[model samples]
Target: MGGPDVLATWSTGEHTGAALDGKSLTFPTYRKGTGPGVIVIHEIPGLTPQVVAFAEEVVAAGFTVVLPHLFGTPGKGLSPASLATAFRQVCVRREFTKLATGTTSPVAGWLRSLARDLHDELGGPGVGALGMCFTGGFALAMMVEDTTVAPVLCQPSVPFAVTPGRSRDLGLSPADLDRVKERAAGGCQVLGLQFAKDPMTGRRFDTLERELGEAFLRVDFPGMKHGTVTIDRQQEGVDRVLGFFAEKLH
Candidate 1:
């Protein structure tokens, strides 16, 4: 609130210029620490200081952390202008599947490719992925691949939920949903967090409960907080993610 650079002071971790070059897409990635692998997906506002701080926490917890600059400026703080810019970009971006159901975001492929590359390089119990806000449901979609051992969804708000049917959508295709269900049945677990009052999330968590049953662990925060993990800086939610990564990726 003081200055744009005020949030810059909270910056930690290193960019290292590491990237994953899929055939079509290329992500300008950031990396830090040295241990098993963990991919921390930023929300619609992109890689802000709070998000970077969360990644740094993962690094300090002893894991190699990779944060792709999906959109927005890295190290930038939340401001009216920044949020407006990001929202405009997201609305027009072809990669994000908004106002649609039973479909996965095209960007999920790039993230999946990133996960594969990270696993190949880091090499451990597989890789942990934590998707926040716009990228939230992406963790679930990415789980269709075997390399993503741990997937966390924090306030996933995708597909817009503009209609009644879309309100219950978690932004996964039929096939991807089936695969995630199978993985859940096979003892794979997922962690999800959201606020009951978050209009952006709608009834997506309810869908997850129905689809994942016992395998999905829903950490519901009842209040006005919409961005659970990073934007609002919920310590408990952050700690839960770190603990989940330790248990799965360690």
Candidate 2:
């Protein structure tokens, strides 16, 4: 976690908490900006400064952004220690399906609820959803809800990629996959970003290409960077995501 202290300047915005399934799911969330809503899910090390900076970028792009603090220290920077701490929490947390194949992380239900609430309040076609790193495939899973119009997956690394089967898994169950496929076929487009050689992302991108066909917008960079919109950010990737949100939501 050796990085600039960008968090000091990060806007606190409107902080609140959300719950679903009575008390089965709950997480603190921060919101800012105004217009079409977008949920920016943070990576493995939790809501690090880079993630916050990226969220601010989304906010500046003229969209309302809601950031759910899933784990780790919100203002902390990325480091080996921070990553390990968050990884442990992910493994122990029932809300996440880290190494489970053909399973949609249980937290997605709460996220879908958040998306629905945002859409209901904003009264738009739908809200945009973007998940990075460990939560990457979440944006795709969130698409099961019609409230998610624009879905962006940035190097979705889950199910750990310890085996071939895990590598190809989209971190979603069969039923959810069917719904996502139907949505794709019915004109919902999914955008995915990853480094061409990133092992963490494994074959999930290929799986997405096959499943969604032309509706899957693929953006691959040349190096092995994992976080496309945060840590090892690419300006083009960020621009593409903002453009996508504008097209689908506005």
> lDDT winner among the candidates?
2
C-alpha RMSD of each candidate structure in angstroms: 3.6, 2.5
Best by TM-score: 2
lDDT of each: 0.82, 0.87
The segments of candidate 2 whose C-alpha lies over 4 angstroms from its true place after superposition are 1-23
Q: What stretches of model 1 exceed 4 Å from their correct place?
A: 1-23
Tens-digit lDDT track for model 1 on 27-105? Answer: 6777778999988999877787778777788889999888877788767777888889898988897777787889988
Model 2 CA RMSD to the hidden true structure, in angstroms: 2.5
Clashing pairs in 1: 99-159
Tens digit of per-residue lDDT, candidate 2, span 1-250: 5243544453454332232224456677777788999999999888888898898898899999888888888778888899899988988878888888999888888888888888889988999999988899889889998999999999999988999999999999899999999999999999999999999999998999999999999999998777888879899999999999999999
Locate the minimum summed-lDDT window of 10 residues in model 2: 14-23
Question: What's each prediction's TM-score?
Answer: 0.90, 0.92
